[model samples]
Target chain A: MRFQKLKRFSCFVFYSIFKTKMVKKLASKNNKIELGLLENSSFKALLNSKYQFSKKIVIVDENTQELCWPFLLTTFEELKEAEVIVLPTGEENKVMEVCFQVWGAFTNYQVQRNDLIINLGGGVVTDMGGFIASVFKRGVDFINIPTTLLAMVDASVGGKTGINLDVHKNQLGVFSNPELTICDASFLATLPEKEMISGKAEIIKHALINSRSFFDELTQYLEGVPNDEILAKAIQIKADIVDQDFREQGERKKLNFGHTIGHSIEGLLLHNKIEVTHGECVAWGMLVEAYISHEVATLPKNELQEIEQLIRGQYETLAINDTIFDSLIQLMKHDKKNNSDKINFTLLQKIGLAKINYQLEEDVILRALNHVFGQ
Target chain B: MRFQKLKRFSCFVFYSIFKTKMVKKLASKNNKIELGLLENSSFKALLNSKYQFSKKIVIVDENTQELCWPFLLTTFEELKEAEVIVLPTGEENKVMEVCFQVWGAFTNYQVQRNDLIINLGGGVVTDMGGFIASVFKRGVDFINIPTTLLAMVDASVGGKTGINLDVHKNQLGVFSNPELTICDASFLATLPEKEMISGKAEIIKHALINSRSFFDELTQYLEGVPNDEILAKAIQIKADIVDQDFREQGERKKLNFGHTIGHSIEGLLLHNKIEVTHGECVAWGMLVEAYISHEVATLPKNELQEIEQLIRGQYETLAINDTIFDSLIQLMKHDKKNNSDKINFTLLQKIGLAKINYQLEEDVILRALNHVFGQ
Candidate 1:
């Protein structure tokens, strides 16, 4: 009892020091991205005030339930009455059956449209949880507290929520925005080193697509997780693109520069039960696409080599080459961006600019895979 | 070969008589409602013209697949090559499992984002198919060809697309508008007499909430399905309310006058495997709510008696008793329109006006149910 009281007292002290007076908020047309200390958030005022929310349902994975939930629960008085829905960790659990179960639980809890759902976990938790909240009673208001680096810089910004259908990634989804997203750096302490590195791949992709300076900065900070500045820049790049094209009908395709190949490779490996982070697959996917860009698109050979070396030095490449190419191409053809029989690619024109709607041939893609994987 | 050619020639002659020059198009900000003859609509110029659609995917139920799909397939050259996804008839199959199977079919068929989905059946087909299209690839363009009178008047207009979660009606869904809603009165010939009467409940609700003249007109024509004028007026009432509040944050609750009590009774009866159409339950639900409105919300006793007489004359009340009131109230509390433990109801102030956000006590609701069902 003494120890518990001490912890609560310390939390109150910490909260008072880092109060919301010095808050950092990024605005997109769809939602607000609150990036700073959790104590210095607008959440405290919103949750503890004259809010009309009937209930608080917090969705967390096994990891976040243990590592992150306590900090917020201790800080906010309103959360004392919150019901927690803990999800199983990892991408493998991101499927429709899991979503259905969570939805059934929501019904059991009598979750209403006026209730606030707080997604307090990594990518799978946020993505699948967001999907669950969005579909339940035709979407309730949700606050995403992204716990992992990958979710903070990438998944946190876009209003994309989905769960995989079989081997296909994000086969079923809806574009539903959350009410607010809070990216607290304190949660990074709970993430594994591998998970942190895995998230950095999206940061690299953001820099590759939009800013040469951000790419240069990413090269210097290779040893550890990205800081607040890096997370903000990466998130801003995504938010800017999404705001301009919320539906991905036009300019937003630029953000999918590495994702087309990344999803195919990731889907293939995950289906076969081979362990690989999404960031690792994306790092390699970028290398393969860079090679293709140099050969076909206007990307210079030296720049392609620079990208290949950067990714090769950072991420350990996957095994198997010639045999996987056919299946890989088949998976790529199933990509959501495609409108025809041909695979749609977003390739780099240069270091900081991307070209969308590139319908490259199968043989060309295979040759690039051979060059990247066969190495 | 001669018969086939003769049928094609007849189809062309029929289409020519009701050409595109005289299209009856009602415009909403979200979607266009193409009323009257389908041949007089813009679908021809869109499909046969310089449109970029790679494929056409038509979603139909068993009933419409046999009766309606052939009509469209023969009329439009584009639909000749269109693929069909046939669902089973009735509300029992409106679940996640069906959506999952349909999504897998979509994957196998390589249905892309730019591809068009044509929903060609009654409420089940349009509601479930719209959801399938909306979620797959984060929404694809779909056209709703509402076959049954219920779907043409109610489901086709509001941009509400969803499937039932267990016995609960439309528990999982999104608010996604269709590209076009083609309401061809010709398909009414395929509907059973029971189904036509089932759809009249909504038209009656529309009249009660909006106009007295329309209600009087409805009283005179109590024989078969509603004509085009009634269809247009019923659709317009729903469309106008939806346009003002698409997300149902405010004024749109007026449309939910009968739904609160209706869904509860429908859910209870459906779960128990008692045969009932949605329209029948809704008719009785209106009677119960009208009784409650008269008791507490300034609705005239004469108006309540009139509504009771009209509904009692039309729909045979379900076998619900006082014992069922507790469970029915439980279901009403689970309604999506509700924000708290109190049941949310839209009560009638007069014959042509509704008051929304009436969170009434359980005793009042029980009294109303006792009055309606005890007789």
Candidate 2:
């Protein structure tokens, strides 16, 4: 494993010097994916396997124009030719309109049916690019080169790709798996601090649901420390769950611990231009939902308190007003996990275990939320 | 099946005495799709068993406000509690933008993650609505109520739902199968002539590829035939193939016999705002590609001539100029089926069997184009 890290470290240095953002993200992010150094070697072998490497590798992104194109050209030099499509970046740009742009690129570039599309960027780039690859001619192959940590631990794995329709986030998408992904921790150094924290939400969720030791490690390094080791641990935790339940039908649902209310808060905050980070909002969601879990859903109170304390330690807590509460509830109803009027939350049954759809009453939820808001 | 059609007929009353374009086409056109009888009953049953249904049914569409809403309310009174979402209609509206509209509706209406979304429209509505349902929260459930022949015979079964991104059609989408699909032929009586013809092309393709007897039956009443038995036969053929190869890895690609070139033509026509139907373009593609197959790939000359004759009888032959040819080729490059510069054509190795990527050179394809254009 240590030798594997050394090899990846060398690969990272080689990938970084001349590779543009697109290829850099691909080589960098993928290199950093903490799915155990040994596991990553297996994934690398899979990429080289006859089944996977039969198609041309095409990296799709706009910002990484200079970055990805030249790098892919050199990397897959023996594969006849490779393609790099540039799409406009940003969430607002992540729509079918962008998909059309990508399709045009596909057509213009002559992307084949079996060719793999390597999406290189943050979530927006990967989401829309993956989407374009997914449906272009009824889906071609795709890989994710998620540049941000949020993407590394979250978007990079799940294979959920989509662009927004109207103001709602990820409103139009698909749940398709990728052929390969390369998440390099080195790319995290390039991201804005806020985006780093945004990625932390998913990391926190992973720690909260599966591994108490991981949680302890994460808490100690909440601000900053030992990026490589922590990243590897986080990646291992997520990969294990994903491997167990790919479709998120059971154990995978537990990954949504903070996401139920977190998504609603993020939706509201994004809609209001409230400038709150995704990780921060999810932290708050974990706090409140954990409290609810303790009271009505059999989650341990100590764990709930610890979760809240940890969240408070990392993020500035916000007050949830009546209007916000109403909207949050309204948004929660749209969550794909809800059954009828019952808004389902993934609760911690213990510090290192989770359960889904812990249906607490509206009043009980409000009380738990109030406690978190310090109201 | 006959009894099923009879039972559905009682409830299939055309909503408006004033026939819209869609209704008029359904009443007049000879698109043989078995609307009332569900063939993939087992698939639906399997899905239902997997998830506990709070809402037994869902109706998703744009024109539902005018057509399906009143009809469903009166007919399936048992579904009075069933939720209905009215989306914006049309190809332009089949986008991530509309998906957001759906998510907003789901949110506003308190649609849960576990609830089902029943798509009730043509290709645009089914594709977009299905895409929304597939990604709502993470994924919920979806059903298809294809009103147009294009959707009923093809889009309804394939689990290929997506919206246009820019010039690319169905570029942003997913391949999540619906729990159920209700392809009521009664909905066709309300479709317009143009829309009916658009769907007819696919019906013709199915007949050409799978069942010659069905083809013989179709030619007898191409212009005007409202017989439910014949329509059901056509739909059954599609359902049979769909059931055999749901993921489109093998036998399902046969369905794209004309689509490689056909889709490029549609993209070019749609982009240039040319007056060409999707089916019509595919019909032309079938003719040209068949010629290429005969000349380059050693197909029986008689089969080639039969294809040409069948297409010529239905469509007013159109000539392709150098510019159009180049543009079409350009679009074909991005057909999501290419490998390198080689364009893949799903051509008939025989009348009943189609081969994919039978690498036809540019000159050979052009010569075939000349034959179709009589150049």
Candidate 3:
């Protein structure tokens, strides 16, 4: 009887492995957009067969150059002729001056429209590189090889590309899609614990907006990199939303659930010269917005408590003073997502459902903030 | 019998006037892109009926603000709340700095995505304004109310919006269409003789590229502004070509017959601080490219001579020395149209036939330049 139980366990493990391989293969082949797992042999084959660029330029941030580019160079022989353009690391570098420098590099190289720009870094590299390619000689084709988990699940999947204007986040940009996106989970292994926590916020966001089961699964794996199945599910959720609304005209706004307040916080911190990861701000934002959701969006009190508990357990709670509250509200007023001076938000109706364009009163917003700060 | 003859003549004149008005009305109503004559009631109706903006902003250059804005304000009551954004007059200001300033103005004004941007000047205003609106907050709706004949027939018609990178013309840009374009012939009355000649070159180009009969008709009306019928026909011809190939990937390239060499010359002259109008460089380009066509693409010798005579009669032939020749050739090499470092020329097979992506040898190009210079 013990031998039979051991055999059943072995079979289950074999089936799981086979299923993952099949899913990866299918992802590289069929999707609304061409999303490929880079480690998949089929993705490598597609790159070798389809793309015959005259020149290939790989744009990498300092961190990515040290951590990601060596693996990329060794895996793809086509990149032997690829020129490496190293940009400085951090969100601070995601500005117009950096774009100007990158554009100048493209001009110097005489990069043609048919040439390939491989954006190999986190969100900053992908966003900036995508914008540069979209404007250079009207438009050029580019591929996103996102090395960070935040990029793989969030930035690289969405066609949105931009750079900050002074202190404003994503103040200047265009809607331009990359030719292909390769999201390899192996890069997550080398990520620092802080970076991992930052990436986890987006994964948690995907779950909170789409599926309760996915949320439970993700929270269980919060201590380390979630398995390929969980990552793919998170990515697919984002891709489905982005595919429905590339311009964020309607359904796409739901993806900005935590982002409204998150961007304000992120922008404020950046402007104040306080270093903070996007995910950390977003994690805090989700917590605050969840409270707002409970009041205005029919989000249940129990679910809100669970969300707050999960987020608070993972991330350090922000110290929100009256001064910071005033500034945050002021920043929210200037958000690009808001129309006609009315602050619009995407709030969770429940654990798995989100409602967009919710206009909340100032008092309610303040009340929500007070609740978040335990005032 | 004499009374009857006079009655018939009056009837014929009345019918012609009615038909022109009817055509103008139809153009504003039913077209792939709305092409409206600015003074017509239909254009005013469109502004009143379709576009309801909370705020209206007019973008004009120093020259246009002085000459055009007052007339626009007086004509349309909808523009009572309109703010004027005056840029410096000249192609020199069509750079990133100007774009930055325009973006800053839009941000300061808190320009919403639905707000109207009226580009009320020449190609420079339309190009820069369109690009700024397109990139600002992903995109905002804008209208082109072209004051110059050059802008009406060419720049404002196509969705190609861009600004120059230093001396290079249209080095950075995006493909974005304006919501509406209003072309008023009355503005031509106030245009300087030099500016009028500049606008005439694009009209001449349309005739040369598409219709021999139109070419003959345009040459007859060379001294001043052509009748509304002739202007509309020129505008229609360009609109048809642009609609056929919006991206310039294939058939649309034929429209760039003179622009390849024209841009090189324009860029070189601009770099050297020689103030040459775009039309003047294009006029010279049509001459040299026509010679190249005769040698390479079997363009009839008689047709080439006719082109040369018409252009030469209208404008002074550019004196191309060996010094300028080298620079022009160097500029041509760096043209965005070229592939694999080969200089591509769009050569005319005949007066009404243009072939694109025709690779030319260096010696052939040199010979063509020498022939133009009468070396």
Candidate 4:
């Protein structure tokens, strides 16, 4: 954990001395992610200096255009001419058809390889925008300005850019990095309470699988918004894992501790037109998986109790129907991580450690689901 | 250029020594193209060995399914269980809608990370299939079995995988290489005379941009299909240039000599419901670009004259309306290569030499368009 902070700090010093824009930044391994506070990151310095983009595009949803775009446009004078493409808000709109429309708009604008795309929304905007830019004439570099807490910590880490296909989560995507990511906590002021809770779920999951010290510190923020230090620490824990395995061939799966069930549940809810935030699904998923981990893997009973108490206090329990357990199993089988008919999972060996490639049987998964839902 | 063949030869030896099967393979630099005669390749050897794919998928178009699939099926017993997905024929079908359908099929088939996709068709199949596999669940490794000469030389050279967007040619795409690319000349037996001429256009462009000696050798195959040696040489020239610069920041643009105008003309025609082969467009485009090279670049007058005569002798001249010259110019403005208002071009300095980054104006492009169309 110290080494992770040390690496990010070294990257900050390197960007400061060379670029002349002093921001708390980290080079997320090979992704070349230059992330910092938006106020500190000088867009004017970047645009006016040696970097000359032919066109600048800001991809925002209806929400971000209204809530965040004005602040961004007035703060950076160089971005006044940047074209704005307002996407329809929410996870349902994150699809290839939407990407196709944005690409059509790009064609209408004659967006070239020299242009830059600034994604100014939550995870959907960043993910869909990243995919659009990555596949447009091979690729065009982009800057991600995540307006949500989930995006700042989660999107800032793995460098995974994607859009969903039907009932499958992130079924179509590529491993592409943004040229830079600007994360200013000021935007979190506009985020809903549920979103804030949704985001904190990830931070809790990060601590559970990465560091005991991180989990211990998170107790104070049980009902409060985390400060900049806590946010940076959560990002670093994920970055440290992703830095080793960008392709998710091995150690990277450790970061998928809760995401295996989270994605399946999230996708099932999304397809059914149910209004469930991704973080809410992930939170419930972690609780269910934590139970399985204690029973199957070597996660201690007392450690599991601590996790259960923390999650129960912060999140509402999901009232999943017993009939839907089979559907959940079906979605898990279709998860992108699985290479065969069996479901693949990453469960806690203990707090601060996770084990990958756990091909848990159907009955075990069903029993775990029942235990969590009290069905 | 000689080092390229030597490098490929060494790679062939490497594959031969390591594996039981011996194919006349040429490793197209980092693309790992295992190109050779179809009969010589052993799918069974590779399948049963260290490689363990969970599923096998073969993507073919209507044309390849009828004329080529039987040959492939009878030869490789290992592919018996492999599911076949047939796509609609032609450049018009090469769109995101078709890809969406194929992805839906992939979902139904439970295509996973360890699955293998064998693209067994012409340029449309290879290109679109490559794109589909590249984006599905982030990416899945694929093998390319090119059934057309255009794909054998061009697609095998540069690792670009793409699909057309609306009337725009290859507007949505990515640069990704297959795990293996097998180019069998036997597929050419089913190819139409028009298609053969189209393939020759690229081979001619390769020589014009790379080697005078290669150009001299090509004059012998004026009215005939190029031998394996000629195909290998054309692939080598492009591969040699691409090995130097894969991203097309510099030298790789030389390959776009014919493509700049070729794409514009191809797109314009396709939009107007006119059918024109990709190679026919390229051949006509080379004549116009050669005209530009003579006027703007320091290309020898004799070299331009030779190119004109050879092009006139092979390709049926296109009757582009005088009014369409403005339309062609408009389409050229939207070309992905252009970074500014001025159109970017790669013109010949001489036979076997190309100069990149020539920002040609609209008026100059119109003049060349008129000259080539005889308006």
Whose DockQ is higher: candidate 1's or candidate 3's? 1
Lowest-scoring 10 consecutive residues by lDDT in candidate 4 chain B?
A: B1-10
Clashing pairs in 3: none
- B1-375: candidate 4 lDDT, tens digit per residue: 343334334534543543424456664576665555566775556666634655889999998887778766766777788899999999999999999999999999999877888899889999999999999999988888887889988975577889998778888988887877777675676678888889899999999998898999899876755666787788778788888898878889999998889999999898888889999999989999999999999888899899989999988887587878888888888898998989999999999998899999987777787788864
Off by over 4 Å in 2: A1-108, A121-129, A162-168, A189-201, A216-223, A227-230, A318-326, B1-70, B81-103, B186-200, B211-233, B243-247, B269-276, B318-323
* Model 1 vs. true fold: TM: 0.95
lDDT (CA) for every model shown?
A: 0.85, 0.66, 0.79, 0.83
Q: Against the hidden true structure, what lDDT does model 1 obtain?
A: 0.85
**Per-residue alpha-carbon lDDT of candidate 2 for residues B118-197, written as tens digits (9 for 90 to 100):** 67788777788777777675577777778777887778766676777655667656677776666666666656787777
lDDT of 3 by residue, A1-375 (tens): 343334334533543553543425223221323323355534455457655646888999998887777766776787888889999999999988888888888878877666778899899999988898898888887888787879888888878888888667788889988877777665665577888889889999999999999998877888766677777788888888877787888898888888888998898888888878899899988988999999888999999999998999999866555668878887787677877677889999999899899976677788887887755
Query: Chain A only: TM-score of every candidate?
Result: 0.94, 0.80, 0.90, 0.92
Error of 3 at A203 (Å): 1.7
CA error at residue A130 for candidate 2, angstroms: 3.3
What TM-score against the true fold does each predicted structure earn? 0.95, 0.79, 0.92, 0.93
In terms of docking quality, model 2 is acceptable
Write down the RMSD of all candidates, one decimal each: 3.4, 7.4, 6.9, 6.9
CAPRI classification of candidate 1:
high
How large is the interface RMSD of each prediction? 0.6, 2.9, 1.2, 0.7
- After superposing candidate 4 on the true structure, give the runs of residues whose Cα lies further than 4 Å from its correct spot: A1-22, A33-36, B1-22
Per residue, candidate 1 scores C-alpha lDDT tens digits across B179-255 of: 88988776676678878988899999999999988888988987765666777788888888888999999888998
Ranking by DockQ: 1, 4, 3, 2
